[model samples]
Target chain A: MEQELISKKELLELTKISYGQLYRWKRKNLIPEEWFIRKSTYTGQETFFPKERILDRIEKIKNMKGDVSLDELANMLSPNLTELVRKREDLIKLNIISKSTLEFYTEERGKDKELNFEKILYLSILDNLFDSGKINFDEGKLILTFLDEYYPKFKGKNCELLFLRKLGISSCCLVSKPNEINFENSMKVVEKLNISDLIEELKIKLV
Target chain B: MEKNMMNLEIKGSGSSEGGKYNTVVIKGNGKIDGNLDCNYLEVQGHCEVNGNVKSESVKVNGNNSIKGDLEADEIEIHGEVNVDGNLSVEKIHTHGMISVNGNCNAESFTMEGAFKIRGLLNAGELELKLHGPSEAREIGGEKIMVKRNGRVKFTRIRKLIMPFGFDTGLTTDIIEGDEIYLEYTNAKVVRGNDIELGSGCNIKLIEYQNEFKQHEEAEVVTYKKIRKT
Candidate 1:
């Protein structure tokens, strides 16, 4: 099903963001240029945006405005990740990935080739989760496998990684949007995070 | 100019239920605290109104600030206007500036000055000679043409005391229509059935269905021909 959309007028009213501020953000690249969708109406052409995406983005920009500059936000938002490679020890020195996770990954993959940038970034996310005790090493393996298998399907779209744990068994799925998961049978949704968010956080730490 | 007309002159702070008046003129620093309904309105000095304004003809020679919407048959601005709401007019000819906090819907919109619009600018026919840097978040109409003003002329001395100078150009997020021609515009995306881009334009993408032409000096990142859906 297609998601509902809201007009520019309605979005301004709902967000209480002034026109100058909206335009300023657009110029700042905090909001992507393509989100402005035009449709002919009874009066004339009107601009609309996907309600969910815009609402989420607006909330994020508002929350992170004073924390970082608009240019920094734009850099974090852009999906272009440069293929800058770092070794296992360097990643550990940068505090991105831990020794334990690298050992586990080396144990999984044959320890003969240089790891690409994507695997390093994924390892960084799993390291955060593993260090914080959000998900176990098995769940981390599942996440890495999911990235290796399913991430290409998302290709330039906002996506989230969902993990559900029940009775010591944890599973993960990738979704375009987050949702409430109530299995109603003693199951709990362990963690839900955007893959891009992980990349953004990692980029920040690396920078 | 019309000394013979019965004018509602606001010399100081004033309020009106906004009845049908011949002309409402604000000569000095004036403020209207209520709705204004008049045939003609002229602001020669700084003015602030707290309510909606409906007029047949409005001329601004100074600064005008309104907190509500504006509806007029014809509006001629040689000064600045700041509206907090929408502007629905048949014709608007501005030689100064107009900043609208809401949408602007006009039949024939012509400007030789600058403007900053927070919302859409929808018109039947929109033509502008950009005096400086102007901006509209979104613009939609049947035919829209904008050209940068590069004529060398002696500006008025009164403008030296005003707050704004000539507009540099225009920056828009999106501009879409049936026929669109823009010069000295920097836009993210422009979609029209018939489109022409003149010089000094830096656009990211342009999707046209019918006819498309661009000047040699203009730069466009992407151009596509799409079938009408």
Candidate 2:
């Protein structure tokens, strides 16, 4: 899907933020570097941003400002995983994932009792998929295996989880920061989830 | 503890491998071969580092060069320094010259000599007293103030070097700040909230929010007031 873009001038006007504030946030790493797109126009070269994402981020920053320092805010907003170990029972009690999801994860992965940040993140993704009624248990196992094998290769980079069904043969793959992907007419894209967004959500839940 | 770490000192022309140190003092020509993490780095003579430098404080009295990025809490330069990568420091007090091939980020940057930054110079409070020609691709900060040092030494030196006059002002592509005051600067676009264009400023456009002032000799082509939402 093509992302809707908003010009820098329009973004500043809409958000009621000054140039200094925008640049300060950028320098503070509150804004990612890839989102600042430069394109040419009749007047000159101008900057653009993904419309919905920028608006949502600005709103979040404004709402969360003054309660925490900018560095803390940057840490919260970033997509990096925290070095934390969470108990399975406590996670269930926190309502981040259900007990059945944990059981399924253990059956496929291992019988390990300790749940690190990575395992919890995978479990949370499975829980989200199960809650949305998108994939079956077998498909969930495939996802877990795929993540266990290839997820580490990305090394904390932005990626996507693609679930495609070609003639009822459900297969999943991962792509890093995919801009565009084309599928044949017979292929069906069941569920496409951005892993960075999932990481952000999981981070909030863990907090 | 840092107190127990060994200090690396090169008294004459020598080379040392980089590592954790209490203090690194180079009195003559010295070369560091790897990343250096230290409490204090002082160079009274010439020094070169082939990797990144992470230090609490850095004091350079002679020529120094770093091949990688430099991260310091405080940096004071009385001579010349060059970095092939980015620079991130809390405070910088320079009276000589410093050049960076990448971006420069600081909390408070006060310069009285000259600088050439190929990338952005982002700071919280930036005060540049242009003793010589300075250049940056872009400058963005909270409060930016640039002024010319109207001393006779520079004029006398320029007269001795060349018969024709030269522009010792700052040259930048874009400058954006909340409070900005420019003197002897040539920029394409300047956007700020409260802006004052001093004499010898040649800007293509000026966009201000609250107030705007221009000196009589400043050559500004266009000015516009932006409404603050």
Candidate 3:
């Protein structure tokens, strides 16, 4: 079978990469060497890279670099900067906490002389439930009362209940008899919480 | 005997030398070194034709085997008919079944039962009502249609490269051993035991890596508009 040959100029044009950058990546062993197939002409030898391999390398580079260069940002904000940005994006997308809600939660917690983890967890759960359209304030309080009566023993252990209380949303009653309440309302309460953040944290801790 | 009703029953040779018949019916078992050329040819018992067959319509009731090619307007086989050469006909209807090791070109084909073919099938409209239990080495055509209620198994697809995509067809379930490369086509539903889509393959539905099924691994990518249909 006849082999289909392509020129280096064509590869560069297709990939939209500078010669210098291509060579630099090639030296770093980021792109496969076999992609640059060499052919001997009458005058001399020429090198050509496969279009697919070049494109794959470009995608890898994009993933490593975030929105802004690290050197461009201030030195103080450099620590855990990527993580903070990622978490913020995730929280916004998941609808766990709005910008205003986060400010409110922070202010309320800061004012408390003794930090009650249970109350904080309850507040977070309530915020998530409301945000997820799981429950309104009135329904949330009723559910919290049900939880207080039925599963009073479970009040302190499950931080989710505390997160709800901390968010100033009804927390206890709903957790105790979660099934008795409307499923949509229950989902709303859970959705309002930053479950994605919790899940990410769990994954980091466990895995 | 007249040329139209020349039912020549040759005990030694199956060839029709002196008679010119419109309808040639072979009664007993015989062998023909040369071809059989007539309007309508019917084989009641077992018969073998060494040379090519040129007729308007050919029907084999009993076991018939042809070494040379069969060229006719319409062909129907009720019993097992093995053709070593190519078969070219306007329309082919098989009831018992057919096993051909060569290619086939027909306008419209209907197979009531199973069939096993080694070479390509080039037809305008083809329908297989029964199951396809046998394996085919290679198959290529423009508008290939198949309706199989039973299991259709292919050991290997050396190259199932459909550049034009599937014009129109449906495989209820397909179990293949090799890869399937499809591009630029649409299908109602394709459920395979294991399926792999080559690069630049555009398909509609792909259910892959299913834990609950027997034929598990499935991968579909580099396509537009894919659902779990």
Best by TM-score: 2
In candidate 2 the C-alpha lDDT for residue A202 amounts to: 76
Residue-wise lDDT of candidate 1 within B153-193, one digit each (tens)? 53454257554844366998888667889998988888777
* lDDT per residue as tens, model 3, A47-134: 5555553564465454544753422221111111122222433443555446554455455444343223333333445566566675
Q: Tell me the TM-score of model 2.
A: 0.91
Q: What DockQ does each prediction reach against the true complex?
A: 0.01, 0.52, 0.01
User: Against the hidden reference, what TM-scores do the models get?
Assistant: 0.50, 0.91, 0.35
Q: What is the DockQ of the complex in model 3?
A: 0.01
True contacts kept of 3: 0.00
lDDT of 1: 0.78
* Model 3 per-residue lDDT tens digits across residues B1-229: 2353555554433554322457767767767777767787888877887777777888888877888788889988888788889877878999876877786666667776666666545454455554434333323222233443333353123126544432222222121111223322232223222343322223344433221111122233322222222
Q: Give me the TM-scores of chain B across the candidates.
A: 0.86, 0.95, 0.59
Rank ordering of all candidates by DockQ, starting from the highest:
2, 1, 3
lDDT of 2 at B39: 95
Candidate 2: the clashing residue pairs are none
lDDT, residue A19, model 3: 39
**Is 1 or 2 the stronger prediction by DockQ?**
2
At residue B198, give the lDDT of candidate 2: 92
Q: State which candidate, 1 or 2, has the greater lDDT.
A: 2
